[model samples]
Target: MEFGLSEDQVMLQETIRRFVADEASLDTIRAIADQESGAQNVLDEKIAALGLDGLLVPEPEGGSGLGVLDAILVQECFGYGLVPSRFLANTVAAYAFGASGSELAGNIASGAAKFGLVLNDVVSRRDSSGIQVSGTSVTGKSLMAINVRDATHLLFYSDDAIHCGAPDETSVVKTIDRTREFFEVAVAGADPDAKTADVEQVFAVASVLIASDTLGAAQAMLDKAVVYASEREQFGRVIGSFQAVKHLCAEMAAKLEPCRALLWHAAHAIDENDDEAITMAYLAKAHMSDVATFIARTSTEVHGGMGFTDLVGLHYWFKRIGVNRQLFGTPMVLRERAARQQGLVA
Candidate 1:
């Protein structure tokens, strides 16, 4: 099989990239980050107009009827631009609702409806009433939850039931990335309409999108660091020309490539509906988590103290990567899963 983007895929990728570059500037990102709503409604509208919100749903359901491969390409561009939204969560909701043959698909694809997923071990099984129903507190704090502020609905999985509920920001805790905040949501006995796949498929897709976000942010950090190194001289020489700085940049790229390839393999496997996709998704999440953290740290170090300053624009990507690294599945948890599957358990 050819391992290259088809003409349509290339066009779609370009379309996404252009829209992001045009609509999501640094000023816009900062504005949204500081906004109370944290909802980029203007940008969201543009994305919807482009038909991206419906990309993953079946054509009959008013979706693009595209596959995972298409979603990955478009999402990767979203990452490259640091364009913040709840695109991944909506995709998960669409898939879950579609798989369950529910009417939620139309709600999700139109952008009028938003969804968030909970993968943490917060709710217990005994609390569940049925397959699509469960119970929980209204104040359960989840780390690095996405799109909580604007989510109209949430998909939650626990030991007992996979469930859904509405957003309750009053119960949400404060977050670092205000633009992508999550709330302390309760199950409230709502039914989710689907079962959790063995590999945590919906969460897996979220992980991949977060990985793509990290990859793009890392690339941005790397670019910013290189420019800073070249311009900011130390000891009467451009730091970028020094062996140490060169190696640092090189290592950043090296760490990034493995994460990129791992995600590519995982996404490809899922699109093809291969048995190994589950295992590979875990591996990809595990690899990208570590790599993303490393890139964030290295970028900060390369930029010295300036990286931490808001004026430098590096901290935004750094914080996003830091948060993404721990979301859905932590690197440790994913690695354990991958290791066990590989029979490398101790």
Candidate 2:
């Protein structure tokens, strides 16, 4: 009946924020531009040491066996810090593998293996015998292929099944967000007989984490914009004293706060297996995408000219929001899909 994080979840979120602030500071991210993968390894090790890699893995498999709500708490912190990692892909893959009783799930849970997501549409066809699985050329230019260089496997789904294959090689592709790297991958020949797990549950899980990420970044932008407004002065008065600046900050907060409830409730809905979980998750994703985009744009405006420059480093958060907005699906795409699911559209 209550809609709030428990004491333990709050502590978990606090712990992650402290670690990110101390270990993965803005300066740390700035220095990693030239060699992101190397820096990413260092970051991954720290995350793994925290056993975050195992957050969704079962206790028997060396993971926390935590549910969706708990995952949302941790992911939100990752977003606030703008920390880059393939933890989201790994989480979805873990769910698929764990649900299917794959031993590889344990490897992933223990951080023994890493994976990347194929965010593009994929097709799988049974090769005559209804077993030899072969379909699309998954190894190509994907828009949001995170952690591809370091991932031992590239994961995608088709025909209601999860498929994993090693990437032959990957080259870093420049995206607007330098806080993280995306790759144009040359997917190596996948094992046609690779393990496959079919379920819609992983989709919901991924959507919730993404929504939580939006929540974190949007919240950070709002906070930074507020702080900056109060400090900068124009015409002998703090800019925040101006009605326009105050309204901008207020409007951002007003739009962003409600996204938190939508995300939290969606995460809770999935964990509880509530009937509305799918629609709720879709709503969370669609709504937060809009919220995040608004915060990113307005927050930058609040900072004026300095906002667009790397000197301020606000662009990192801003670009991350842009990437998240377009990542899994755009706001319109998600909304239309939700409508179809609710039978409001054909």
Candidate 3:
């Protein structure tokens, strides 16, 4: 009946937390962001050294074969650091490929290949953009393909099946969040084999991971706001002494704390293959999106004008939360999906 992280889970979280603190500090992330190439390569090396590249892959595939919850913990740490890496996309890809018994899963687990994700069409397809599969050729465009930089393979949905293909031509898409990269990929005559995995299960796993990322980012913002309030002074008194600032920080903590538990439960549901796993994933994503947005805004307000400045660097977490809200599905879209799953909508 223990409703919390196990001792090993706590240790795992702390290990990644320390690594982020030492290796992916704000300055370090800024330096990597400014680089033109080899940035992700460096990160991949570090992650592989930590044996994190294969966190979700099966043991037979050289991975630890951990569950979704363990992956969630690692992703939360990445979010807190705002580390610009493809851990999110790669983890999901590993799960998908592993579930389907794809050979590429071993490459991913062994760090021999990187997998990018182009499943936006699965959530909400745009008439103007999508991957078209014809025979052995895949053609068309995906406006928002994630982790495409330096990816050796792309997982996308086409012709009512999940297809893995090598990216043909890709262009970076600029966004407010610089911590992660987005690309517009043009698929042309790539691999045509459709891997067999539960599409709904993959989507659910992706949603929970995204929600966990936001949870970590929100927690970072709240911690930063608290630290800033305790140090910054107004009218010869620290802002932390003010009831307004205290309430802002308190509200952020209160709102963000529950999200962690919600995400944990949702992730556990995925591992257990519970009947409500899909519904819980949708609900967790929707709730975290809304609450994290509130915490991002309130945390920024607590820092005043400095929050918007580069010196404070609060915008990194803020922008991360913003981008996460739109990824996969927005709160409104996810809420409707949850309703549909629960038979509350026609």
Candidate 4:
């Protein structure tokens, strides 16, 4: 089946593209990454200024009450710009709370308390509690955890409900970005009142969002590679003159287009409440995870050694895709789920 974006969807994509071009340019993102400071809050306000925060929440929750497709659009743009904010976390949590009939929905819709959804295997079966979460906030020490350092409320899951202290320097471990530490949060006594039953549902959205982000990052890498191939000289002619380069570019596009179609198919299925949504969502994520990683790596190949340096910005997307792949669930895990659904045995 052919999938295409509606006129409204096209407009949304364009608006977001313009915003990223104007506000979160390569220079801007580089500056933020360089400082090791959290720019998610600042960027979140900018996105709020665009009125995107209300897209996923219900009308009763002070939002525009659109749907997941809108959220997918925002997710795509966020990936394109590499804005490391709690937007994804907040969106999923707000939706989960709305699903659970919790008062937190309103706060989430208004961006009052930042919500970071934790979907790691270590905590997937756990329940929420009042304990403090002391650890890393933004960097790799948290290993794919989003905006953990700046989060005010964390939607945590585990074998049972437990409390974790608020994150701080001592609790988190330092990694790629020093200012952003990944903390190993410890949980304490159960608090039934603090737990919510919406963890699985929220995780579904988180996985989908991460997949969408990877899609954007992959597109960026492909675009860069194509441009470099056409402009860079080898021996006496452009590298684009080589059949090998042409074939690689073709392979990149081949991987990207199908992933895009699968993504929209999954997003639409979920929005329309179709039974096929889950299967499609997992398939899309798994496929995109591989494609995003390949695009990043191959783009570096197309650009030669120049791509490895920070000046090229190729590594940023490469690293981001690597981290994104592991979040919610790895590509291998999603593929296994999809395969099982298809009744394919290993």
| Candidate 4 lDDT over residue span 1-346, tens digit each | 5568888888988998888878887776776776634454566578778766556778887877777777887788878777665667777766666655556676677767566555564322224322333332122222234567656676655443322223433254444532223444432222344455544345566678879988988888899999999999999999989999999888999989888777887888877877667667777888889888888888889999999997887877888788778666777887776676567856
Residues 33-149, candidate 2: write the lDDT tens digits: 556446767887788788776677788877778878888888899999888877888887777676556666788887778988764342112232111125544434344467776
lDDT of 4: 0.68
Instruction: Give the TM-score of each candidate.
Output: 0.86, 0.89, 0.95, 0.84
What tens digits encode model 1's per-residue C-alpha lDDT throughout 203-245?
Answer: 5666667677777777788888889999988899999998999
Candidate with better lDDT, 2 vs 4: 2
- 1-346 per-residue lDDT for model 3 (tens digits): 8788889889999999998898787877776666647665776678768878788899998888988999999999988888766777778888888766777778887888787889878778778888888877777998778888778888887766677888889989888888777888986565645464477788888899989888889999999999999999999999999998888898888888888999999999999999899999999999999999999999999999999998888988999999999999999999898888889999
The Cα local distance difference test for each model comes to 0.70, 0.77, 0.85, 0.68
Better of 3 and 4 by lDDT: 3
**Residue 199 error, candidate 1, Å:** 6.5
Q: Candidate 1, TM-score vs. the true structure?
A: 0.86
Residue pairs with backbone overlap in model 1: 125-160, 132-191, 132-192
Candidate order (lDDT): 3, 2, 1, 4
Q: For model 1, what is the C-alpha lDDT against the true structure?
A: 0.70
